[model samples]
Target: MNKIELLELLHQEVVPALGCTEPVAVALSTATAAELVGGAIEKIEIIVNPSIYKNGMAVGIPGFKHVGLNYAAALGALLSNPKDKLQLFNKITDEISKKTIELIEKKLVIVTIDRSKEVLYIEAIIKTTEGTARCIIKNSHDNIFLIEKNGVLLSEQKELTILDNQLYKRLSDLKIEEIVRIIDSCTEEELLFMYDGVLMNTALADFGLSEQNKDGLGIAHSLKKLTKNDVLGDTLFSRIMVKVASASESRMSGCPYSAMSSAGSGNHGLTTIIPVVEFAKYMESEKIKLLRALAIAHTLNVYIKQFSGKLSATCGCGVAAATSASSAMVYLMNGSTNQMGKTIINMIANLTGMICDGGKIGCALKLATASNAAVMSAYLAYSDIVIPSSNGICASTPEDTVKNLGRVSKLGMQTTDKVILDIMLEKVMNNN
Candidate 1:
């Protein structure tokens, strides 16, 4: 791919998103459907793919103390501005929250799994006193493909077809060395977007650091305690873990802040970007190198996800995205393409199988573990230590190992996703 076209791909893939994106996607679709009807919506019927339902079922929505798709859909209908995209929850207010809660208590919303589609699908139907509206968002989390009112078409966009055919094809085709060169060749004008990512995600890290979390489990809190007790003695590795995990903690808790996301996930953004930034700062690397490294890190993430489907039963943040962070850290340490490749294989060989049960506060713990593995693999590769392809499922080449990992997540993990969802559904039902 031409370097110029790669820039456009970067702009498209990296974006700011609020809350857990699955729920935010839900909010966007319901709000769009409700707005078209233009009145008090009496009922909402929402059908979502397994991944959406699996993710949205447990994560809390911003500005609300509850968890589930019912509340997210109701609030999306009540307070959403279709203009907000994935960040729609940022504008939620007290009155709207109260009204949405009332709607929930009255049992006016229904959510069900859509067996018709495989991934990233949401179909919302809203009925008001005057008429009914329907909206369909599919494939990409932010894609709004179809909208209608009273069987009259409101709009049409080919999100599903275009995303899979054109956009993803270009992204998936990019080579790792080509991606590194593209970042290294860019001017300062081109890096402003990445710097914006540094500013946005770091603030969330600071906020996460300040949280007085109970159970001693929040990433910042836990890391701080470990440092104080002298168990984790390396300040550099500890700092990297704290910064990356803190950001995940903030985002996973619905901190009401939007993260500059990579490949449709805020946690993926934090996992991929913040650790590389921290390593640069600690080493006093030049601004240009710092910028280039971040660009490479994030692009590496998007590149990997092209093989590993965007949504998967496995934790993308830990396995794929953080693996990118490890490779970027290797580059910052002056490791060559061979060393970077080794780092990629080393990390994926270890962390490839972490299951993504759901998004919640506990996800920060997994992010911290991934960050540790990222730093460890980088250091190991710097010393010429790597997991050879002969070990287990690792392929001879780094990119091939990544492909193997993707195949395992996308194709080899069906029974895993089903078992996880079954357990989660059982718990939710038992609680209710």
Candidate 2:
């Protein structure tokens, strides 16, 4: 891709999002369907691809104090703004919550399994006083497909076809040396532009720490303890991750407000930001340096996910955040391009298999695992215990390892992703 193309890709990949992507996607689909009828909705019937179901099960919606597809569906009907894309359900208020609860009490939400096509489909039907509205999202989380009311088509599109040879596949085909050159040579202005990430992500941490929204992991508290106990703990970056993760926990558990999301997840954003920011603080790095590091980390994540796709069978945090952290660690250590390669290899070797069950408290465990691996891999790379190409799935060099990693993420784990989703869906259905 050329410079302009890369920039466009970056803009698309780094857009902001509210709540967890899964539930929000649910809300978007439902709200769009509800909007079609132009009246009070009475019932919602939702069918999801397995991965969507898995993610919806774990992550919480903002203001719902719950973590499943039901509340998300209700919130979509009560508060969704169809124009807001993935943020359609951002209008939740006290009155709305009460109304949503009343609807839920009526047992109005229904979620079903659809075992066809891609792993990221959500179809929502809203039955209202006027009639029924239906909306469908396919492939990507927020790509709305069909919308209908009273058996009449309200939108021209009925299905969203998955684009073959997506961006990640294209990026994976490039040489790592070319990518490193682009990252290293960027102007300070471009690099520092991403400082907005720090500001935005910090806001989330603060919100999560507030007494009103304290359901998720206490990342802020953890950071404070880490800082207080260890003299090195007072670094700005550590504080950032703690804050970011704490807020993510809150948001994932249903806190209101949006987060600056990378590739459709606030947690992914936190994973990218907190680790990079912490490393910067530890090094007392300059703003330009931090930006470059963050840029590299974020871009690396975007690049990896290009192959892994948006919603993957594996946890994207392990791939995106871990890769970003590894790159940031290299930048912090002032390690050369080769060291960067080593760090990436180490990260892939360590975290390529972390399953993404969904977005919930348990995701924090995956985040922590990936973040710790990033730090360790960075430290290891600096120490020169890099994995050789002779090993299983490892390339002869570090860059080759990245390609191998992408292959594993995109191709090798395909069935694993499906099987896991099927099992989870089966359990949900059996229990229901």
Candidate 3:
């Protein structure tokens, strides 16, 4: 791909998001529909694909104590702003929270799962005193395909499918060398926006490591305390792990801060960006080099997601984003593109089987693990050690190996995904 195309891809994929993308997408859909049929919202109904239901079932929503799709939809309908998109909750207040709770208590919002829909799908229907409207977001979060008001179609974009198909095709065709070359060709000024990710996620890590905000799993907080006690040495690996995990903890616990999401996931952003940033700090790398490395990391993340599909049973943080982070780490070390490819091979070999149950506070542990693996894999590749092609799922080329990993996530693990969703659904039903 050319430089402009690569930058466009980064702009599309590496945008900021509040809360988990799944629930945020639901909110976006509801908000859009509610705005279309302007009036006092009487009810809201959201039907989502299995992946959305699973991920949005329990994750925290930003600035709200309640968590789940119902609450997200209620907040979205009440906000009634499609333009706010994922950051719809950025300006939420106590009155809004209380109104959201009132709507939920009245049982005005309903969420259901549709296993037959696309992995990233949300259809929101809102009923107001004036009329009813519907909105459908498919494939990517915030990509609205259909918007209707009072049973009449207000907007429908047929060209989006063609554009999305072409985008994925171009992404899947790229090789690691070409991606690195694209990064190298860019001026540091053009890539300076990449540092925003470091700043945004570092804020989250700082919040997680703080003593007071102990809302999440506490993985990062505990790890930091261990370092203070000298129980866990203040090594580069531990620091990177703690940083990434702390960010995840803060995000998963519903901190109001936004994360620069990579490949449609906030946790993926933490895995892909924080490790490379922390490593750059440790090596005292140049700012330009750090931005270049981030460019590589985010671009490779989108490339992997093109093959893996947007959501799957496998943890995208481990297999996709961390793989990119490892390759970027290699780039930061002045390692060859060939070494970057080897780093990817090492990452896939190690993290290929990590399952994604769903997004929750526990995801902090997975991000921490992925961060550690990224460092280890990068160092191994720098030392000229890599998993052989003959090994399981390892291919003669990194490109092919990535394709293999995607196949495992998209095709080989269908049953695993269903079972995990089934378990989560059963628990929700039992609680109800």
Candidate 4:
């Protein structure tokens, strides 16, 4: 891909999001449907595939303390402008929160799981005095595919397919060398947007470490305390882990800050961007060099997700996003492109089997682990230490190794995904 094409890809994938993408996508669909009907909402019904259902089960929504798909649907139906897209909760207020709670108590919103649909599917049907409206999102978050009003089809556009058919295909076909070349060819002016991500996520990390965010998981806070007392050294690895985990905690706990999401996930963005930013700061690298490293990180992130699907059983933060971050770290250290490839291989060998049960406060732990591993992988690759291709499921080349990891995620993990969901659902049922 050329410079312009590379910029287009970054613009499409690296954007701001509030809260976890799965539940936010649920709200987006409901908001669209509610706007289409244009009256008092009598009831709302949300249907999602198993992957969406599993992911939204325990995650917190932005601007509210409540958690689950029911609250998200009600909040969208009552007070959301569809045009805001993923940042729909930017204007949520205390009164709105109370009203959304009343709507939930009234039980006007119902959510169900459909096992037969695609992995990323959400359908919202809203009933109003005026009419009933339906909206559907598939393939990726924010890609609305169909809309209908009063039994008549109003509009239909498959935006995801259009991008996937052309740009995504080109992206998936490029080798590691070509990806590095594309990042090198871009001017610094075209890549400054990545620094915006650093600022946004740093805000989240600050929130997570603040005393007012008492409800957060406290992993980062505890790490900082340990470093202060000499229980843990204040090294680069610990700092990177704490910073990235803090941002993940804040996002998962509904901090209301917009995260610069990568490949449709806020946690992925935290894992991919913060580690590289911290490394550059420690190394005292030039601004242009930092931008180029970020370009490599974000590009490789999108390329890996092209194989892993938008949502999957595997933890994208650990396996896909961190792998990209490791490669970027190698680049920042003035390591060759060959060493960068080895860094990718090391990351895959380390974190390929980490499962993604759902999005919740506990995700902070996984983000911390992934961040530390990423730094270690980069260091090892810089020292010329790498996992041999003869090992299990590893290929001779980085591109082929990524393809192997994709196979494990897409084909080998189907049964594992179902069982994990079953266990989660069983717990919910027992609680009731």
* TM-score for candidate 2, residues paired by index: 0.87
Per-residue alpha-carbon lDDT of model 1 for 1-432, expressed as tens digits? 666776787787788888888898888899998888888888999999888888788676766777789888998998749898988898888889888889989999999986557667899999999799999997778889899999999788754543366656776766667677777789877876788888888887877787453322466777867876679865888887887777777777777667888878888988988899899988799888888888888888878887777788989998778999999999999888788888999988999879999888778888889998999999999998999888976987888888898889988997898888889889989998
User: In order, what lDDT does every prediction score?
Assistant: 0.83, 0.73, 0.89, 0.88
lDDT of 1 at 292: 82
Using TM-score, rank the candidates from best to worst: 3, 4, 1, 2
> Relative to the unseen true structure, what is the Cα RMSD of model 3?
1.3
Question: Least accurate stretch of 10 residues (summed lDDT) in model 4?
Answer: 157-166
The C-alpha TM-scores of every prediction are 0.95, 0.87, 0.97, 0.97
18-128: candidate 2 lDDT, tens digit per residue: 788888888888878877677787788989876777788867776566668888888887775778877666677789888878888899888887766454788898888
In candidate 1, the residue pairs with backbone N, CA or C atoms under 3 Å apart (3 or more residues apart, or in different chains) clash, namely: none
Residue 10, model 1, lDDT: 79
lDDT by residue (1-432, candidate 4, tens digit) is: 677888898988898999999888899998999888888778899999988988889988878989999898888777658899989988688988887888789888999989787558999999989999999998888988899999999999855552366888898999988999888887789899988998998888888888888768678898888777566789899899889988988888888789999988889999999999999999899998999998899899988988776778999999999999999999999998989999999999999999999998899999999999999999999998999999987888889999999899989998998899899999989997
Candidate 3 lDDT, tens digit per residue, 1-432? 689888888888888999999888998998899888899879899999999988888899889998899999998888887798777878688988999999999999988888987568899999989999999998788889899999999888774542267765787788889889988999988998999999999998888888778688678878987887667788998999899989998898899899999988888898889999998998899999999999999989888888777889999999999999999999999999999999999999999999989989899999889989999999999999999999999998899999999889889999999999999989998998
Clashing pairs in 4: none
Pick the winner on lDDT between candidates 2 and 4.
4
